[model samples]
Target: MTTSTKQRPEPMSVRRRTPAWAKAVIALVAVLAVLFAGLRLSVLPGLRDLFGMDTHDRSGPVLLRSIQDMSRYEAASGTFQVVVDLERDSKYLPSAIRGTRTLYVGAGTVDAYVDLGRVGRQDVTVDADRTSATLRLPHAALGKPTLDPDRSYAVSKQRGLLDRIGDLFSDNPNSERAVQKLAVRHIGEAAKESELTARAETNTTAMLDGLLKSLGFKEVKVSYGT
Candidate 1:
């Protein structure tokens, strides 16, 4: 106890600190790794899309037969313009409650033609002297009407309250198709009433007369089949 007990101070512990540059290097490496991973994911998908590898083709080829032996000669043409009003409703009591209406304006042309193939060799008579000829042509027929897509358009449409709800549950009526059909029918009727057949016959006669006259025939006669 008398011996001045000098308490020996315990050796101070020393903690080593990492350098600032090393911390910065570690942070930079981590950022580079993240960027590299992002680039890999984005570039692979981009390349696939660019090369169309990610897309699927769901359509196949369509083939059609070639049309042959069709000799079409237009003899007359008629243009008709009309407005069609189409109305449809569910049958029975529902018709009064649920009705639909559509109006459309359509313009179209009807062409008339004569089939030359129907003419037989006997139908054409050439005099022995080759100075006169008589040609018999077939009757005129109406071709399919061609609608003007640009001019044809729906003018108005109306759907009743109940009809609107019914459309949600049932298939909707095709107003455009109905209107188109009506247009065709109306145009055809008008064309027939306009004497398109008579015009076609007249035109055909003139055409044949001119052609035969050009062939050194002094007299040419053209007649149409009944």
Candidate 2:
């Protein structure tokens, strides 16, 4: 009866449980590491805040902006121009096909109204002859402000009101460098980058197609204005 009774303990070996495909491969590696950390922390800053100020880049699909003539306005009296033409299509997104003071064309007024007893107004200006491509007007100050119905004075002593407020702020830096250069040139022409451009150079198919060819109505055909 000595050690023979201890053999009963060998029948107690029952340790089995823990494999449902190894707990489904550890829950599929913790759901692919929580989907790659939610695509590196919330989908890359929501796409850089709807894409803007990424500095832009297209390398060379064409981007040129080299106009000049800005020296304290070179003697400002209204005739400071630096224009060009050629834009099959543009609506702003990241522009620079050209800049540095653009107004391709504007500030054109040829109004002539007079009658001393009341109504009075005179103006005729169209400037921009960047070395000669034609476009400079004033016709000798429109013939020295014609309206001589027995002149006595009141044309603000020959165009005054501080010279019409310095000719209406002298084209305010050429219409604010042509709207900050057409809003930095089409900011990518769309698809993103904060989209908001395409004023298409003051609508009407480019300002009434260069103002109906400077009113000569050069084969008119521009109706866009939305």
Candidate 3:
């Protein structure tokens, strides 16, 4: 029988099946990756827009704007701090229902401007020799004061037991708005007393005087309307 006894092939080891949990984990990982990719793509446009990345330098004006803003005076008022006491009581038993007191502080700014666009043909007169010029302008007026909502805040709030109990059920939404209004009123009054109009007038005169001199006029005169 000689040397060659047929050698039987070693039995092939059976491949182990993957565990259910392991397969599930792999599937979950794949699903999460896909979802994450989709979410990133979804917010890409918003991110780009927020950062102004979608804009280009191709500039064009579709229409010529006639009106212009010549902001001559920027009058900022001093901070106004006040405490407001608010009371809302039952019509019959006024003392039984107590109220709240709030301390509010606010600041604002007012602007004064001259609109050159409003000047009429007759408003400007150039002397025959072109050595003198006169310009008539409108009177300086106060702009609406804008309350800085960010800087304005409620310093403190004092609420009675009754008020607290009532607040649990309903909230007073108008309190903050009321505070802002009060601050704006005080700022407006303060700005009116700041002589901003006179400052604006002086600035306007100086500005025109320089402009006329630059244009070779020996004498320049500026007048304001009532």
Candidate 4:
């Protein structure tokens, strides 16, 4: 008994300490929350400005190129998109050391046209009464691929250590000329393989037929030259 024996030892006061990682996570979350609030409130200059995102266009004034009269009728046009992947690799080095790769998304339009200026007196045949007419027209031709700057862009690019270092001294380091040329070539090839010309011929024929009928021709026969 001895004075109710030694007082029961007070339960050791246990204080759990938060792990370092957990504390760090909490701090990061708090910072992010504050940033989000600032962004939402428009009190920040935005992430882009904060990260020094900027662009300066020092392009020269556009010169007026020579103008030429055009007499071609664009009968059909086709919109096209292509992905160009171009790469260059060093013969004795790995990609990470001396290689470069680019991915570009190109958008353009190809026009199918009939050159009305090419048609002459010999190309048209008319009956004595002028009630019937026949037109021999040149085959539809494809126009140059016109790339859309607004819709065409470079998706991604990767360069090796040496290549990146070299770019620092290059005049046009981020040039997309190669990929743009490839894209144009691919688009031209695709247009050639498509039925765009055939469609153009059909449309031109319809247009001619309607016009001839309105002009008092009872019969209109349209044919294409080789």
Question: For candidate 4, lDDT tens digit of each residue in 1-226?
Answer: 4565567777998999999999999998787556434454244557555676468999999999999999998999999999999999999999988999999999999999999999999999999999999999999999999899999999999988778768768999889999999999999999999999999999999999999999999999999996
10 residues in a row with least lDDT, candidate 1: 34-43
Off by over 4 Å in 1: 1-62, 90-97, 166-175
| Tens-digit lDDT track of model 3 for 166-189 | 665676633577667777777778
Best by lDDT: 4
Q: Predict model 1's lDDT versus the native.
A: 0.82
TM-scores, each model vs. reference: 0.66, 0.17, 0.58, 0.73
Candidate 3 Cα lDDT to native? 0.71
Per-candidate clashes come to: 0, 15, 0, 0
Instruction: Supply candidate 2's per-residue lDDT for 152.
Output: 18
Candidate 2: which stretches are off by over 4 Å?
1-6, 25-27, 34-58, 64-226
Across 1-226, the per-residue lDDT of candidate 2 in tens digits comes to 5666554555667899879999899998787557434444336777656664557666866667798643121111211112222233234432333112222421221112111122113222233532212221121111011122232111111222333235446755223343334332332221122211122212323543475477654443422111
Q: Which stretches of candidate 4 lie over 4 Å from their true place?
A: 1-65
Sorting all predicted structures by TM-score, with the top scorer first, yields: 4, 1, 3, 2
Which pairs clash in model 3? none
* lDDT values for all models: 0.82, 0.32, 0.71, 0.91
**TM-score between model 3 and native:** 0.58
